[model samples]
Target chain A: MAEPHLIYFADPMCSWCYGFSPVIAEIRRAYGRALPIKLILGGLRPGTTEPMSQKARDELAGHWTHVQEATGLPFNRAAIDGEGFLYDTDPGARAVVRVRREDPELALTYLGRLQAAFYGEGLDITRPEILADLAAEFGIDREAFLADLDSRDLKQETWGDYGTSQRAGVTGFPTLVAGPNQDGAYGVVTRGFAPGDQVLAVLNQWIEGAVAQH
Target chain B: MTAARRLPLLAALSLSALLAACATTPPPKPLSQGRGAWSFAPANRSESAKLAYGIPNSDDVGLMLLCAQPRVKIWMSQPAAAPPKKIALRSGKAHGVYPLAPEGEALLQATMPAADPVLDAFAASGELIADQTRLDARAANERAAIRAFRGACPAKTR
Candidate 1:
């Protein structure tokens, strides 16, 4: 039987992906060695400086409240509005790239933490100090992490990943791709925030089909 | 011809079983059901007492969200909820009714979007699905927006 690889493409700043974290983790633990899991960064809103309009901000705040109602995640809009922080996600994306170089395993964890810190706790992740604070919270060596943040290598890697995802035509965050192993490569694309059951159902169907082909 | 002949029958059965398994289609999932901790009272003065979240409007057909926590109640007046639409929750993003209606997912998709604490309080006091968090936040955001909108639409208020 050919094993299937499941790839989750997402951004750390994405709120929906953050909500899907526990469910995905549960699925991974449940499926354990039966399937291989891969994480890809789908860069959302890269290189944008214009601050969100008040109307847009209010709409987002309401949306956050609704999300909290559904998922039980915290959201303190005061913190979001207190500081004059532009919702620039570039710094946070750069940080994720930095962590990928040092500890590839923890890249997704960093993404989750950053999402929670910004969306949940309303921290301004764009600021370097705040990013360092988040890194410290995760017990990562701040000095090493900071050095990576400054590295040209990390910056290039972030841009490179962004370009690849764009070329792949990933329009949004939290896209999951699962397909058959084509001689060591799995190519399946599951898009958007689908229900856990839906995701599992899709995988199961694909697996059965693959077995028939074999 | 006794035991040796039985092997072919067993192999036939195995192949049939595998083919059946391959042909089995998955069962459709049930619709996701759970009340959002928030809902809203109707905006029409005649139906204002009726609590709702996504309600239709007669005019320019925009989106509106009307919700009530336990203590507070408000409506997203500028953009209103249209029919064939319901506010729903997904991982983090709030997709409009069109994307969610067919899927029947949660209406409030925030990370802990509802005011469960307040809901619990009401529940303890013998309230049925009185979402306190939804009510409080809904009221707060609504009041603030109305104040701002009123200022912006001063001529229309009277």
Candidate 2:
């Protein structure tokens, strides 16, 4: 039988994706290698050189508050409150693509760190240097990582993931899909944010059901 | 049948089985995660003489430990749910499964003696997960709430 796997479509800059982090972590904690999760970065808001308007910043902050209230994850509202702040998501997405080439699973872990750096710590994750520093924490070569981060090919590949998300018809951040079952059918695990235990239960049930079928 | 004829037939059967084993739909589409987080308010208020502790992001505690004198009711509020018949809880090394019932949209409840060791294990454990819900039981305010609920509620029965 073909081995089963997970495809997680997310944007590192999305607040609800940050909220969904703990749930994915719980899945990793509970299942480890028994199930493998592949990360596909959805380009939430890419290639914007224009600074956010006051109204846009206000609207984004409001969404962050809702995410925080729902998931108990931290949010530094002031992260983008400063004047002339740009919210380009390209760098963060490229960084994950870069690291994914070296250590596929580490890509997911690095994505989590980038989310924490962006949302929880209020770090400007839109910068290549900042993204490189986060990668270095995982023992990646800082200079090599930065060089790759600046490459045109990685930029195209990151955008490719966005295309994949669109083709998959994912209209939201934090869309998790399960399957390629024996019938090769895929199932939506959760389109939006869900708590850790709930996700863990669903995963456990999937395993149990597969075993029952045998 | 002759050995050569039988050999060819066996080989054909094996190849077909191998092909079936590797068979998959040429292209797989996304299956949606059909469920979202359940609603909480109704579950929070389901019990009479109810006292609750916060579980993050929710002002309403759908998962409750209700005070009913000598027994504490472990009520999980699940609206329009196909919940497990028993709640499997884990907080660190301490774990147990308690039976459950559906009172309405929310599952009715499962009660244990107030002094049940599992309750202490649940309280002392770092994080509490009841069935599919993870609970924040580590906060000081919540701990105080637990103590207060226990004090005001003497278990009506063991």
Candidate 3:
């Protein structure tokens, strides 16, 4: 029998996903391969150019506050002052795609760090220089990361994932789907930021049920 | 095999346009409450809706609509006494939700034509990291605002 797989559908730019990061890490540690993990990009706001409107910004800020209070995550408001522009996630996501291509391990590490920068430190991920600086801090080859930042390959990959997110009916970030692969597989799907314990329990129950089915 | 195959790429794409309540109509009635005092109205064309009963004790308020698409929710809010956010009803599960900011309203109304597509795309990606940042930033900002509010309003608003 094949070991069940865990597919995590998320975008690097999702707020709830950031809140769930620690929980996801814990799940990976516990279930390493009894259920392997797969990361899918949910593509939050793919190609936006205009800065966020004050109305939109204020509303969203309210959401951020609500989520933080619920999840106990640290958030920095001052970060907004730095960019003073509508934040975009594409650049940050592209960097992740590029890194994942060369080294999935490094990509995972970088993603965690990137999340911290955006959510914890409130650093803007939209700017190339900001992304490049982050890469340098990780001891990543700066020139290479910059080059790949706009690489056709990574762009295609990001688009591909965006397309995939669309197909899955995954309209939000922090969506989790577990089941048999596209080939009539069975798994689980946890859509947004629920408590991590709830997520783990759901996964555990799903795995147990699937095991019993066999 | 490349793990990318397992990434559900196509799924993300198809769902992108349907993510936001930015350009659509309001859902139906028979409302119920949601997270943090928010309420979800009946399902409409293809989604549900949420309305906050004013923020905590302040006149600031919010309204959200979630499409039948299941997870997609759009919200709009105003500071107790602002114009009901002027949003054009566009095709697709798109609906724009904004707070009552004079500056935000000007841009939202002025650039509606150009801004829609961009806003739609961002809503589509729904990247986890981006969500995290926005949520955290909002929280941080909110905490500060609340602190200031307490200092200013103390007994009444606090």
| Residues B18-126 of candidate 2: C-alpha lDDT, one tens digit per residue | 3234434222222332322221221234344445433233212346666665776776543211336676766667677877643322133677676665566654543
lDDT of the candidates, in the order given = 0.49, 0.65, 0.51
**Tens digit of per-residue lDDT, candidate 3, span A157-202:** 8878777765765545565665443234443345556676666565
- The 10-residue segment with the lowest total lDDT in model 3 chain B: B26-35
Q: Which residue window of length 10 is worst by lDDT in model 3 chain A?
A: A205-214
- Candidate 1 lDDT over B47-83, as tens digits, reads 2222333211111111222332222222221111122
Interface CA RMSD, all predictions:
13.9, 14.8, 14.6
Model 2: residues >4 Å from true position, as ranges?
B1-158
Q: Which ten residues in a row have the lowest lDDT in candidate 2 chain A?
A: A205-214
Q: CA lDDT of B97 in candidate 3?
A: 34
Which portions of model 3 show Cα errors greater than 4 Å? A1-3, A181-183, A210-214, B1-158
Across A125-190, the per-residue lDDT of candidate 1 in tens digits comes to 877778888888778788887777757877777777766665654444566665334433444444
- Candidate 3, residue A22: Cα displacement in angstroms equals 0.9
Give the docking tier of candidate 3.
incorrect
Provide the DockQ value for model 1: 0.03
Question: Candidate 1: lDDT over CA atoms?
Answer: 0.49
**Poorest 10 consecutive residues of model 2 chain B by lDDT?**
B34-43
The numbered model that scores best in lDDT is 2
